[model samples]
Target: MKKLENLQKQLGYEFKNIKILNEALTHKSTKMPYNNERLEFLGDAVMDLIVGEYLFKKFNKIAEGDMSKLRAALVNEKSFAMMAKELKIGEYINLSLAEENNGGREKISLLSDAYEAIMGAVYLEAGLEKVREIAINLLEICYPKIDLTNLVKDYKTALQEITQADFGVTPVYELTGSSGPDHKKEFEIALLLNGKEISRATGGSKKEAQQTAAKIALEKLKK
Candidate 1:
């Protein structure tokens, strides 16, 4: 109860219907009577609209495709997970003991869904204006630089950029290894820049590992 009160204070918006807030943080894996899936859907739509409007006004010359990609990057699951971590939201979540033990609190998908559910709940408790303020603040805090140039650029994009700009040859990625339990396997990926080993990284998924490798390569090239 005290923890929930502290969380509410940190969010700066007291829920008129606390149940909505509770529902938003509930994960279906816990077999809870209520989950935040519906709220997550609604919040996703709301998030897109807010981000779209912000980009539309700020980057007037930016194309629709570019704006959409940037918005997606800013509001992605990983981004939400970061925000949840910052807020220590996992500690406040109501979860079964087993789920908690399995690191449910730190799960990216679950945290992202909870973030969206909170948005939906806020919109319902207050209004669009309140939710908009919250969304803008959250985004601004998460990305102080707001560099749209690389916001949505993934490992594939980075590799392509490096290949075109430097070697004039495309990079290739190879799966080095995969380890860990089935539910929590870690992938090892290596990216070769024009046939030269550039960087390698490990992640929970192949795409993620590739992205990490590309990111490291980008940093190395920059340095």
Candidate 2:
């Protein structure tokens, strides 16, 4: 509770219903009665609205597609997790021992969901205007960190360019394997150039895997 209070001060928003705040920080894996799933759902909608409105007003000259892309870049799991880390929100999150042992505190999905839940809690606490204020404030903090140039590149194109420029060979991607339940399966992908492995990455889907592979290749080459 002390941690949450500190977080509220840091975030510039106080909850009218403290229970909601508590619930927002509770992970579903704990099987807690007041889990954050519902809040996460509502927060997802609120986030889309706030981000859409911000991008629409801020980038008036940008095309709808680009605006949408920017919004997506801002609201994804990776960005949300990064934001959560910045806020030190992970310290306040409540998770079961099993989850905590498995690195739930640092997990992107949990962090992102917690971020959404906080948004939902804010919306419920003070309405859209207050939520908008917090959302915009956070957006300001996040905007500079978003690399739009890198965000705009497609995986295949980016990988090709990197491999071609770096090693003078076209990059090839192979579906190494996939596993898990249908709803939450993971895919492993490997990127190769000139018959040598450049990098490998895993993701929830094949396309994501390719993008992650490309991102890994980018990091390797950038080093």
Candidate 3:
């Protein structure tokens, strides 16, 4: 077995009970005496509480709905996977021969679960405050890279909310035209509100074009 001392070094917290750390890295596919599922469950809840508290305190004036969205963006599987990759958690993960042969080490779901399991183990061996410090340090590294504007839901939804509130009607998107080859095509889209064309934009796909149009419309509406 590879040494976990490097993982502990990366985490900046050494486990007094190293067995717990091993269990955290063990997947169900390994058919070990103990696996990470229980630890993952605990870690999930711990993460939620920690992230929610952080966001609540940090974004004091932000609306609850917006805060919820930010929390979701932070605690999501992709975010966890990114953190796991940064920590090289995959290197320490224990998988069966079949799973290893099938490239289980690079699987995002497994990495994310293992990350949470490690957190749970950290909490168990240390305490909530210790785990919280580690989690916050990881999140600090992650938070700045995230673009909150892009993380907001599709532009159409934002446009709909603005139109509904201001005009008591939903905005509509129309495919204006397309150009180029099918594989590399570009689409043009227009946004209409209450039967009046508000804005138009182009993108690499119909969805992207529509979003661009909606974003343009939103900019116009906000002016």
Model 1, 155-192: lDDT tens digits are 57866876688878877889999999999999999898
Candidate 1 to truth, TM? 0.69
Candidate 2 RMSD computed on C-alpha atoms after optimal superposition onto the true structure: 13.7
Better of 1 and 3 by TM-score: 3
The number of the candidate with the highest TM-score is: 3
lDDT against true structure, model 3 = 0.88
Candidate 3 lDDT, 78-172, residue by residue in tens? 89988899899999999999999999999989999999999999988888999999998898887765444556657798889878988899888
Pairs with backbone N, CA or C atoms under 3 Å apart (clashes), candidate 2: none
In angstroms, the error of model 1 at 206 is 32
Model 3 TM-score relative to the real fold? 0.71
Which regions in candidate 2 have their CA more than 4 angstroms from the true location? 145-150, 153-223
In terms of lDDT, the poorest run of 10 residues in model 3 is 144-153
Show how many residue pairs clash in every candidate, following the order shown.
Answer: 0, 0, 0
User: Considering only N, C-alpha and C atoms within 3 Å, which residue pairs clash in candidate 1?
Assistant: none
Location of the lowest summed lDDT over 10 successive residues in candidate 2: 144-153
Residue 60 CA displacement from its true place in model 3, Å: 0.4
Best by lDDT: 3
TM-scores for the candidates: 0.69, 0.69, 0.71
Model 2 C-alpha lDDT per residue in residues 86-107, reported as the tens digit of each score = 7788998999999999999999
